[model samples]
Target chain A: MHLLAIDWIFLLEKLILIVIIISISLGVAMYSTWWERKVAAWIQDRIGPNRAGPLGLLQPLADGLKLFMKEEIFPASSNKILFLLGPCLAMLTAMMTSAVVPWASHLHIAGRDVPLQIADVNIGILYVFGVVSMGVYGVMIGGWASNNKFSLMAAVRGASQIISYELAMGLALIALVLHTGSLSLGVIVEQQAHQGYWNIVLQPLGFLIFFVCALAECNRTPFDLSEAESELNFGYHQEYSSMKLGFYLFAEYVNMFISSVIMATLYFGGYHIPFIHIADPNFAALAGFIFLFAKTAAFITVFMWIRWTVPRFRYDQLMNLGWKGLIPLALINLLITAVVILLHTQH
Target chain B: MNVTQILFWLLSALTVFSALVVITRKNPVYSVLWLIITFISISGHYILLNAQFLAVVNVIVYAGAIMVLFLFVIMLMNLNADAEPQKNKWLQFAGVIAGGCLALVIIAALKNVDAKARIAETGSDIGLIENLGKVLFTQYVLPFEISSVLFLSAMVGAVVIGKKN
Candidate 1:
């Protein structure tokens, strides 16, 4: 009976950690808008959104409020329930991916150890894949419920594109999984931190394939074929107005932010301080959090930079690149990794 | 009730409810969405059984990939309530008879099992990736490879059928 008792302290710690993590994700996603605009402006030789606050820091807030204040236009022909469920689903799935991600090293406080992550589920990476795959429903439902042809077309494109890229992404990850021999993100990060050799050294080719597939998954340029403005007109979220549209947009930024964290955590050594060791556990954990944040920020900057740098891929080109280019490359990388690991183990 | 028992009951109700909704929904898209919900609740059941790998992969494969493709086809078909073909009352009666027979078979099949067998209560490492992978690769290797080959053949058959001269 005593063994059946619940750990209230564990639940409380996880609850607090979840709240803190989601807020940080939201804040980062908000500022990611500002950062994207700044990057886009920089590339185009223009000052971007300097009006809202200093360095346009408060622009995301103003933009969010503006979206909130705008009229919500629900189409007469739309399926009301599914239409509303669409954006909510998008936001929910986007936030759900963060549950397994280890944000930093374990913190020691008041003679108790606290981990930054919410749920370090056993099948961490697979759980992320499951949630990420479910993201397509938001686009699909939003488009289908709108009862608009353009929206339907965009949704079909978005759905297929995600499905295609996920294969390459999964294949790319198989190599890393084989190398690490574990699926837990915390364990993976801990290994990288202690070993001082990031998975990137052995997984550069896989990382490149992963990076391209990630771009496709995020629906950023040059893989932004689903929302091609020249043809699909406002894309899957076309008929959405006000905060509904805002949810769709915010979900994209949230996804981008989360993917940045995932890439940093996977390829780079997440939260690992390069060439430095701190004695105090609490201070080290704090430093690790900042380090992971900086790496994630770097990845986010690269995402935005590429978005502005490359033109959108043609629909056929996007499919070809996903199915033809990246998948085979990832497969070859997997084989090479397998052989290397085999030889190393035999020695 | 224990946490495991409570969660098991909740998930079972959700699965049954959503599965019923899936069959009852007039709109094809709604039916597909409800089916996804059914699959997800089943995945929850897997989680409750401490089959973490099975649970997430169920979500990834069934609810995520297969259901998306199902929804995609239904969406593209532009099906409506008006488009649904009317079923004869006798056909419905026949379906009920068929379903009852299936249920009878299942119940009779399970009658020999221990009724008090613990499922969700025990946190078993048998479902963990390491153990599952080891067993699957060794003892069940033949079946695993055969299923993979079957999938490959099916895929190849699809491509061949889909190709135009």
Candidate 2:
């Protein structure tokens, strides 16, 4: 059988790794919700969920249980299949982005080298961009399927907002891509490690633009016009209930976690510790994993911090900032990078 | 069949099915969603052919950006309800006949082609981003630059059309 030509052991190893990474992502996303609330309370000078378990670490689990027990409501006038499909797509795209992220350097175990990523495809950054773009559909479909005027309006706002910011985000990323000259996330990280300077140092303006666009992309504060409560009354997910609603909310946190990881990977030198060196490959790999996790966690905290600190933008203001402010800035950054690279190469 | 062949067949079937659904769906929003599914299946085919960059770009451009715009316009028009006006019976009949004739012509044109001979293995590295970029810059530089100019003009045209007096 030609199928026998495939290495079963390697496939088994990858399957196990996939399972581990997925569960870890879910666990991190669960805790991020708890962390977000706690941070919000702290910023507001109030005690956060302390009753659940050790600083309310288990609060997310309780919340999950509550959501599950809540009654699922399908609006009589709503499109049933599309309504359900919305959150499912949101969750699916959220998880899909993780496939290209390299958690750590390869681990050498039992004389076999195991890479930490799922698929090290050549277009890793583009793959993430593609999946991130797909996330807009979840909001658009959910809002339109609700058969509510407000929801439809919010969905339209969301689709335009995402499209506007995505151009700036792409241009900002192009500057970084020029510096690294590779689309592979692993290669980008390695380049940063070898160069001993993260992309943020060279592309500070690009990073700022990218970070702002990331906030807008994730529908977080300052750019969260899609879900502006006072204006649109909870916006796109207004008709969602029970675990269906939970999935949408959970998907946001998951997207937050994944984007944080991407930001850390792209700008903060991924798994490369600043001044640490270990001779042993195994020890180095372990340290890289821990360092990458620490970086991701720090970024997640920043996301929550900004979410609590900033006010949501008005819809027109959001659109203006995305189109007028970020896009031109990103284009300028790209041009400057191109010129610098050309000069450097000539010299 | 081998795994690649099996995957190709599966993706082809999915793409065809979704394309049919895209045309047949009564609701325009549902038609747009099915169109997205068709694009995704086409991307799957690109991946099977080892063109990872093309696959991801296809999803990003077609299924993600363009389809979202399609859905956005559909929602803005409030066309989720069954509002499409049925075409005249004779016009519909003519449309079907024309479509069938086109299909027959395509099949006939390909009938004498050596399909097996053309099914040779593609260069694996040709689809990699590095090689693609090199070729684009060195060999196709003029066309690439001209395409950007075209996009710039299109953007300007859109702005002009969208501006309020």
Candidate 3:
């Protein structure tokens, strides 16, 4: 009964924080689409999308408006309900991971200290993994509901690809968990921040495995066989149009943004501003938030850069890399970590 | 009612409703989706018991991975209502009778239990990852290792079955 006591201020704070985080995620996702195009253009030696506003800043807005205005199409053969459920689920799973991510250390407001995260759940990393796994259903159901052969095929490929990469991703995470000895993202980040040495320095191989898995998990290029335009003819979202299609596309960008944030938080000393020390608590919180955003932005840029630079892998090659290459490598890394910890403890 | 009691009743109701839907759905795909809802409601019950690790793992393993595989197989087989053959009337009658008898037997077996004495306070931290990990590695280490070996054998069996002729 004591645990069930309701605190109105705490509830209100969480509600407001949730709203802010959701809006921030949506805003970052919107800009990521613009940034992706800009990066692609720059890499190819072309000025990209400079028409909507200064340096094509308003292009995502234009794209959003166009998608909203487009005709909504539901094929005659398609399952009406599940087709709609697809993008909604996609958007949901994309946003859900943000709940556990510690955006900054802590902000003191009105004589009260507030944690910047929505929920510091005990099993934060597992929650993220669960939500990410659920993300496959959105693509799977949407493609199947379309009632098209190619769409179904694409859905199957997407589901299998996600499952395959997830094993390696979990293995990579286990290695890091062994080093940190915690499942809570906040605890992991705080440990790194206190020590001033990120997990990346100690777990370089684990980070590389994790980075590859993140690319596959987000369905970025070199791993985006599900939506290969040349082969599958627009793939899973082919039958979707208007806002439905926009949601699926938007969800992809949001997933990218979240994964980039996850990468920064898990390995790159999240919100840990290095080489500069601040004594003031309030100032440190703001600086930490900015530093985390900068790291996430850098990761997002790398995601886009690789998307443009690397060619799409053949399906077999993708499977081989995930199952044979990354999984075994991650296992070896975990074994090495365990042995090192054992030796150090004995000494 | 207390918050915990209210949440327990709500989640139980959802689980029952979804389980009913799972059994009654005409489409296998819809049935799978309803089963996922059932799993999610059960996970909510686990969370209510403060087993956060089990709650998340239940969703990841059952609703996420297993259900996705079920959906993939259903799609691959193109299983539709039209493809399902109707059972004979006598067989259907026997199924209902058998199910009712099983339910009666279970109820009879549990009728003697003291339910009120078994009720305990919730929000225990024993279900947290750290506590559970310690218990599993220290006290249940042999069983854990045995289960992993079982999984390895199952995997090898699957590979053998899946090999091309």
Candidate 4:
């Protein structure tokens, strides 16, 4: 008699999980800025952001408010719609990537077993790459809409860099996909948890190439040629102000967080620490979330450390590393992996 | 109609709308962006048919990489609505004739396609990667490898030409 039979409970569960994950991602990205400053301060022998709150914990909140309160400027010569579209697109793509990532094992709550993920789609890896590639529009449209030459230059650089690294990144990911034989992130993580060793043990070179590509992808230091202050003058977001600029900056951190989570999922055994077994399923799920969180935190710290430690790469060097170095290295690793898999199967 | 039908109609409208915008836009950057939207909506249609692999690959390759290069070239040229070159009347007439001929050909080609005769394929797994991969590697491996060789040669040609220039 009903028009449509619906699983309302399932719908409600997903809604709650969505809210929680979004909050966690935003919260983590906010704190990551604090952590980055603290790391930078530590490196330079200075105490950072003690005045904002305890350990400058509220600095991000302060920053957010300042951004919100700031005046918004639409350039007289700029395309108004695209200028606004840029930041929103960036933020949207950043948030969309979390949809395919399996955050943890199944959770037993409200008398129903709920997965701690949004959508564990079959083409999860491709979905991530597609959404990430879409992220270039944020920079491209934003910079172009600024009607500034430097902004245009930055956008062009960013678009090219992202396009190049995505090649190497896809090549690197192919080796892992070949090893796992599944594009689903959930399935890959489950395989790693059940297997004795993580994929990193089998594919270290793939991990390295993937890591470098990730740095380039996120526009992080050393690979951040598009945002080179000396040459491009703050790069793509140069004309963006108010909350729009904040969104661009926030999207970058979210991207970094997501990439680290992806690396952990693909290489590190995600939530599974080998030989440490927990009998209770619910507790195991909770522990898995914690483990995944800890790994991402470690990765974020490493990202920050690299940002402070390494000097930015020259444009040509960056291109050379991606094209000549990582691409060839990834190709070799892929070949080796194929041979190994083939040999093992013959036995 | 149900949700699937509703989604089909919605995506069809979106695809047509975006495609029209792509052609009509004065600014090439905006045109490219609209074309990207058109491709995305087409990908949505692929997903509606449960062709997950094709849907994602379309987005990753066509909408992501190819469209970005188009956008890059257009943006670097600093072209705008005001800068768009005017076309000649006879050239425009010839262009219209060509496009109309293409539309006619496509329509004639698809006129024999009768979908209603076949059973509605609900929950078909043929579009899934596992099935696609098996069929492709086993039955269509020769063509697949040949296309890849074609792509490799194209890549080499591009690199060689760029180096020489």
Candidate 5:
């Protein structure tokens, strides 16, 4: 309402959230690489990056430093303007989407209660999806600008794959919206405050479709035709290296983290725990924040687990699942949900 | 003006600017990008409306999915500015005249509107979906039911167009 504004207090709060989310995303993206290596090693019965630091935990740090120290090379024939813009855009958009996610319930700082989110806009989910969608441009622009056939091809695949999967993903989310009857993610989580029951219980099909689309959207393997190393030799990022390449790589993890958090918020009842109720306005907000992060971490583990387990899909098969399978199923799910809601209201 | 009102004006200006860019940009790719900026700005407007549901749906459907498809098409076409046919002179003339008339009409309409209309202050707590549902099913039941049919027809239309060889 008229109460909403970019006032100093609100601006300060938003800035803090941005700073926190960006730092966490960067840190997680780095650690996730090590985590992926360790997880892969454990699965394959081999030692991971154990030499960098105890269990190679500092490996990401070492890798990051190497990227910074490496020479900055611009391809001779590339569109230099767009080339520079691509990775920056990629990293920026990935970091930007996390702004709306309800990270905590609420915080009571300086005797004033504030929501632990940057902006509790009515369309939190849509905003997340919008920002996430913008990410493809970074890949597409980067790939095209590289002027490398390999990069262009990879970008094409990335674009196509994202387009196909997103339909299914959006449809799946529609069913959830129908169930939760709200688009504000903060409100959605609040409805599930009693931890015992979550949207996953009622919308399992939606969850499955959502998770699959998330994997594809994040460009993880099995759906990562865009970056099939065996075929494309690093895909859209073929011409990228050093920090530019690091941006592309890190952005993927940041997206994975954000998507995982979104999934947790949607299905697992973000930051909601039962019996330990904090009805006090200030305390409830704080509790909500903790619940959100915990839920997000759990979903992140699931993302890692699936990445390790699944084999990359054939490009055609991936399209088929997205367009032919999931989309239609999601539509059917929405129909069924509508009918159920109608019947429930009647009763 | 208070911070929220100042912020709202900034966001609204950005939205309008991006929307204009969406239409005016010469590069197809840049046009798509501008449209995305428009989408994000509109989402900002939704947040302002406290209709968070509509805002998210707007992003998910328009910015997230549809815009991606538009980008994919533009990329597939691999269009360059020079590759595009130059605008016809008469068409440009007509467009300018029409645009001028449209701008004049908008300004005239705005002039007649009450400048100090009471700004409806809806709280953030009333979630969009529940309120939308109540309004949709009760006050707007007929229109809501009709819209479902319209959506169904649109779905059919999409399938028909997409399926054509």
Candidate 6:
């Protein structure tokens, strides 16, 4: 009976952690909008959103208010059920994938150690991959529901793009898996406890492939063909307005945040501070959790940086990279890694 | 029986029903819908087996990508419900008989094996992509490489069959 009580308490703690994570993600997404505009403005030598508050910090809040005030519009000919479902599904999957990520090591609360992650499923990496891949459905469904030819076309292109890059991403991940010999994110991070000798050193090619695929997967710039402004006029969610539009946009940023966390966890040796091992489990776990957030923030900034710097790839070129370039490169990387592991084992 | 057992029965029924609809349904859209249902129920079975990766992959590949392709092609071709050819009753009868015989054999084989709970009690680095890759490359190397070649050959065959003169 006591054991069951302890388990229930742990479960409650985990649920609270997840709720906190979700709120933090939403908050970051709101600020990200302000940061993006600021970054873009600075590049163009202009002050962005200065009217909202000091440094325009309140811009996100103002924007949220404006969205709330605006009338919700549904297209007359649209499929009402799926139209509503599209964004909700997108947001739900985006939120759910965050559960498996080990944000910190175990933390001692009231003398009982609590895991920072919501669910430390053994197949954490695959779960992340699966959820991220499902993200395409939201856009596809949204576009299809809009009952517009352009929307349908954008959705089709988006779905094809997502499916194509996933293969390359999976292949790149295979090389990393070969190196780490584990799929659990927590175990992978633990393996990379030492700083400077991260998996990035052994699998630079995999990191490159993974990062490029991340950009394509997130539908960010240089691969944001699905929503090229002049071409598609906001792409898949063009018809969306108000909070519905907000959901679509929010889901994208949340996905970006989660993928950045995944990348940090997977390749950047997540939550590991080099040569500085605080022996206390509590402090170490706290440090690791903070390190993860810090690393995730850095990746998010890099994502924004790349978005501003690079030009969008043409649709055909994007497809070519996925099918011809990245796919073949990934295969070669996997083959080489296998041979290396084989030779080492033989000796 | 407990909730898990009851849920298992429900999902198994759903899987069987969807599998039947996938083949027997005349409308291509309905076929795709049935396939998605089958995939979801299979994921339920994987949950029972404690294999999260397999469950997610079952949904991702079978429902997400494959069914999308099926739908895309059907829409592109404008396959209408009325245009679908009628199913031959004799073929249906033969299919049911074969399926029933296969199920019986499977059940009989399962009954002969000792039933034991083998739930993983320890947290071990197993069933991850890394282990799967190692096993595939080391022990199953020939089959792994051969399957890729087989896939390539099948792709070529498909292109040949699909080409418009």
Segments in model 6 whose C-alpha atoms lie over 4 Å from true places: A1-6, A194-196, B1-3, B6-34, B75-148, B158-165
Compared with the true structure, the alpha-carbon lDDT of candidate 1 equals 0.91
Question: What are the per-residue Cα lDDT tens digits for candidate 4 across A234-278?
Answer: 999999899999999999999999999999999998877678888
DockQ for all models, in order?
A: 0.76, 0.75, 0.77, 0.73, 0.44, 0.35
Ranking by DockQ: 3, 1, 2, 4, 5, 6
Write down the worst ten-residue block by lDDT for model 3 chain A.
Answer: A1-10
Poorly placed runs, candidate 1 (over 4 Å): A1-4, B111-114, B117-121
- Give the docking tier of candidate 4: medium
- TM-score of the second chain in each model? 0.88, 0.91, 0.93, 0.90, 0.85, 0.64
Residue-level error in angstroms, candidate 1, position B72:
0.7
Which ranges of candidate 5 are over 4 A from the true structure?
A1-14, A107-110, A274-295, B8-26, B42-58, B85-133, B136-151
TM-score versus the correct structure, for each prediction: 0.97, 0.97, 0.98, 0.97, 0.84, 0.85
Off by over 4 Å in 4: A1-3, B108-122
Q: Could you tell me how far off, in angstroms, the CA of residue A237 lies in candidate 2 after the best superposition?
A: 0.9
Error of 6 at B107 (Å): 12
Looking at candidate 5 chain A, the ten consecutive residues that score lowest on lDDT are: A1-10
- Judge candidate 5 at residue B64 and give its lDDT: 69
Q: Look at candidate 2 and give me any clashing residue pairs.
A: none
- Candidate 6 at residue B39, lDDT? 88
Q: What is the C-alpha lDDT of each candidate?
A: 0.91, 0.90, 0.93, 0.92, 0.82, 0.83
**lDDT (Cα, 0-100) at B7 in candidate 4:** 89
Mark the regions of model 2 whose C-alpha exceeds 4 Å error after superposition: A1-4
Per-residue error at A124 for model 1, in Å? 0.9
- On lDDT, the candidate that comes out on top is 3
Residue lDDT tens for model 6, B82-132: 886789999989999999999999998888676666444323444445566
* Model 1: per-residue Cα lDDT over B35-61, one tens digit each: 999999999888877788998999999
